[model samples]
Target chain A: MNTVDFLNSREDLLSPGISACQGCMAELSLRVILKVLGEKTVLVVPPGCMAGAAVGGWNKSLGTKIPAAMPQLGNSASMLAGIKAAYDLVDPDVHCLAYAGDGGTADIGLQALSAAAERRDNIIYVCNDNEAYMNTGFQKSGTTPHGARTSTTPVGSVGRGKVNFKKDVPMMMAMQNTAYVATLTPAYMNDFVEKVQKAATIKDGLVYLHVLNPCPTGWGTKPENSIAYARAAVQSRYFLLYEYRNYEFTVSAPTKNIREPKDVTEFLQKQKRFAHLDEQDYEEVRRVVNSRWENLKKLAGL
Target chain B: MENEYRVVYGDSGLYVLDTASWRTFRPVIDETKCVNCGTCLLYCPVCAVKKVDGRIQIDLSYCKGCGICRTECPKQAIMWVKEEE
Candidate 1:
């Protein structure tokens, strides 16, 4: 849809004055998501920054105009599974959505999410990957990049930030042949909106969307730079923007045409989390990001 | 029973936070340059930017002043004015 058409789409579903940090991408994401999902949507935001920010509501009330709930950290997927099943009998038109963090999806709730995908549950699951558990003081998550520092992955003599590379959740889901799996960022609004609208249409199986939620507080980025950093992340190919479904994988726009991606350092240097990374560290990060991009390309070729 | 209900269920709008104080900068929309393209309205985390009547207006009461609207505006119609003491 064009800008003017997008303007008239839907009213913002979130109540004003949520406590998300300045330029909170996750908050922007949730607002747009709920707008796309509309009133017939039932939202389940697990224990993350979004939940702590009151998407699930506070004080015996609801934060969203629609009914919402905060499930246990690990039970987010399973709980949504149950709710979607119930909604099938009661109101099948109702959209059942789970907005979770990487800590919840990759570390804690992987099994349940996997099971739901395998069983072909018609639910939308979104992992807002801020790269760490930001609400709980930015502990390193399974999706945290190798050289980025978090509270747990300090840049001290003993620790060189996160030791391992980020776990590729969307690729994993795509490999399983889920109904739909896509990575998105708000920086690319058209692509982001189109994918979300597509996710809402699939009634055959579970849809997994991993959104780049840049945490201004946790990542030590200027709040205004969140979208710019998001755009850079894709430009540098540090995070590939692509979608998978029906055994077909296609890289989306922004990063799709680039031959030589902008240096990974262009993306990394802006964040305080990568402040301590030296030339050697940048080399390793470059290796990891490039390999992952090439791997996705190879998979697409197959 | 009424006292217990009041304490537990809470007063009206008890959870609504006034996020205006979080601002370090305020987005002032330049009327001459703005065509009401709605980019600012699209990217706001709080959805604080709105189109009231024919013009785009920002609700400062809820605007956290992240300056996202300013940076993303195509015409550079929104200015980030510093909030001073």
Candidate 2:
């Protein structure tokens, strides 16, 4: 199908009237993912934003006709693995998807995810990293960037937000030798859909997608700036877009060039979470972002 | 006949939900101003705007009134109107 036709042909997998906050990128990402995966897919969501978007309560469900299973916050990966194994026995053609938040993927559910990756489970695991525990009131998560204030990492007289850098979950998953591992954002819809399609074709092992879901509520940004922040993140090199498969690493087309990269501070300045960042903090963040950009360029053989 | 207390699966199949109640501002398209460029159909996060019968149609049931359609419309076709209580 042509680009427009392909996109338009997608059945709306997410039912409307669900309680997702305005300009919630997580909800948008799920909409795109469901459009790509279709009705044959089974989603295994944990206690995260996606879960709330999918099935709000016992009486209300705005999710698609595709079957969904809600596991505990830490058991999403294992639960998906078991479900995938059952699908393998019954119908190997079925797709099993695990959707979890950054806290669930990078922190609490890391062990389960690691176990699934080690076993080469045939499933697609999507980590909707909004950078904080947004559903539970914007607490600091493992993927929260340094110097970003959160409920748990408030900017106090003696403390300056989170001290550590965001955990490299994509790289960690790539190290596990998964069939496919990629990082994407809703700003680039075509690329995101292409990557999801590619992940579905890989049957040898797990497919991990670390999507940067910008949370307007948690990031303290205007609702309309959700896609703008995501684009700024890529332009600033804070979130590099790339995919790893068969030991081949390649940067996606949109983020491959850097004639004159935008300043990382431009991306951070818009969000109130970084309001407390001083000049020194900005410099430190720039240094770290530059270092990662260099490493990514080397890996991409740019 | 007995009242069934069991939960029904897939209550609405492709039927639009009435999300107008959730919106403080509702989008109204000016067909005269609209060029039928389909730009709003591409940017809507909820897939609320679509092409029907070769014309642009906004499904208000699922529209959260994010005003993305209004913001992205190239011809200034869509206008956001304050919802009356």
The global C-alpha lDDT for each of the candidates, from Candidate 1 onward, is: 0.87, 0.83
Off by over 4 Å in 1: B1-14, B52-54
Indicate the docking level reached by candidate 1: acceptable
RMSD of 1: 2.6
lDDT of 1 by residue, A109-162 (tens): 999999999999999999999999999999999999888899888888698899
Please write out the lDDT profile of model 2 over residues B1-85, one tens digit for every residue: 9954434246543223455567888889998999877767766777787777768888887678777667667798988889887
Candidate 2, A205-250: lDDT as tens digits:
9899999988988999977678778889999999999999888789
Q: lDDT (0-100) at residue A174 of candidate 1?
A: 90
What's model 2's TM-score?
A: 0.92
Which predicted model would earn the best lDDT? 1
lDDT of 2 at B44: 73
Clashing pairs in 1: none
